[model samples]
Target: MTGSELKKLLEDSPEECHKLLMKEYGRYVYAIVYNKLRCCGSREDVEECFSDIFAEIFIDFEYREAYKGDIKNYIGTVSKHKAIDFCRRLNTVKGRSVYTEEEDIRQLASDFNVDERVDSSELRRILLDKIDELGEPDSTILIQKFYYDMSSNEIAKNVSMTASSVRSRCSRAMEKLRVKLAAAGITR
Candidate 1:
C-alpha cells in the first residue's frame, strides 16, 4: 500500500491500521532489519529493532505527514535506520570506521572481486584423463588402493604382485599424480 492508503486507514481505526500495517510489512521489516543487524546483533536485537520501527511509525506524527513514498520504502527506511542504531549501541567499533590512508581503501577494494566459478564436469574429466595417463598396474593399484580403500595386501593379491611392490607403487603413483595435477594448474 502507498502512504496515502495507510494514512486513510489510520484515520478510520488506529488498531485496524496497526494490524493491516503489520500484516502487510512484517517480513519486509524483518528483511531490512536483518540485513543491517545480522553481522553485529543477535536475533533479539533484530526483533527489538523491528518493533521500534513500527512503534516509531505509529507514534511519529511528523513522519506520517512528511513521508509521501510507498509504505514499503518508508518501513524499509525506518527499519534500516533502527537496525543501524541498534548496531551502534551493541558494537562500539562497527558503526564507526576511520580510513586513515589510501592503503586502507585499497585493502577494502582488494576484497571486492567477483568469485571465480569452477566447472566440476571439466575438472572431473581432466582428472580422469590424468589418471589414465599413469599406465597399467600403477593406475590399477592407485584406484583400488585409494578409491576403493583396499589394503596393500589385498591390492597385491588382485594385481598379482608382492605387498611391498604394491605399497611402493601406490606411493610413487601418488607423487606422479601430484606432479601432473600441479603441471595442469591444479596445485596444493
Candidate 2:
C-alpha cells in the first residue's frame, strides 16, 4: 500500500496497520539490522534490534508527519540506527573500545599541520568549521563515512539512502571539502 493509505490504516486500525507494516517491511528491516549488526553482534542482538524497530514504529512513529516520504525508508533508517546503537553497547560491554570522545579529541589534536607556525588546534577548529558549513546530511554523511570509518552500505543504512547514493554524496561532499580547504590554502 501507499504511504497515505498506510497512514490512514495506522490511524483507523493500528493493530491491522502493524500487521500490514510487518508483512510489507519485515524483510527490509531485517536486512538493515542484520547487515549492521552482523559483524559485532549476536543473533539475539539482531532479533532484538528488529523487534525494537517495529516497537518504536508502533509506539513512536508519527505516521502522518514522519512518514511523508516512504514507510520502508523510515523503517530502514530506524533499524540501522537501532542496530548501530546495539553494536555500540555490545562493544562497550565486551571491552572492544570503540572510538571514545577522548580518543576523538586526541585524534583531532594529533592531526597537525606541516607548518609549525599554524596552530594544530586552530587548524582543527577551522576544518571542523568548514565541515559544519557543508551542512546537514553532507556533513553527517562525511563524518559517518570517513571519521567513523563506516562502510558505504552502513552509512546508507544510517541515512536512509542506498549505498550508491551514500557513495555519491560522500564523493560530492569530499570535493566540496577539498575546494573549501584549497580556498583556505590548505591543499594537500
Expressed as tens digits, the lDDT of each residue in 57-155 for candidate 1 is: 788732448745676766777788888888888787555554468888888788765442246646765776787689878877876675546799999
Per-residue lDDT for 170 in model 1? 85
Candidate 1, superposed: residue stretches over 4 Å from native: 61-63, 67-69, 93-102, 110-188
lDDT of 2 by residue, 89-141 (tens): 88889999845698788887898556764577578768767887998689878
The best candidate in terms of lDDT: 2
Q: What is the lDDT of residue 80 in candidate 2?
A: 81
Give the TM-scores of the predictions, in the order they appear. Answer: 0.51, 0.49
Tell me model 2's lDDT, rounded to 2 decimals: 0.80
Q: Measured by TM-score, how close is model 2 to the native structure?
A: 0.49
Clashing pairs for model 2 are: none
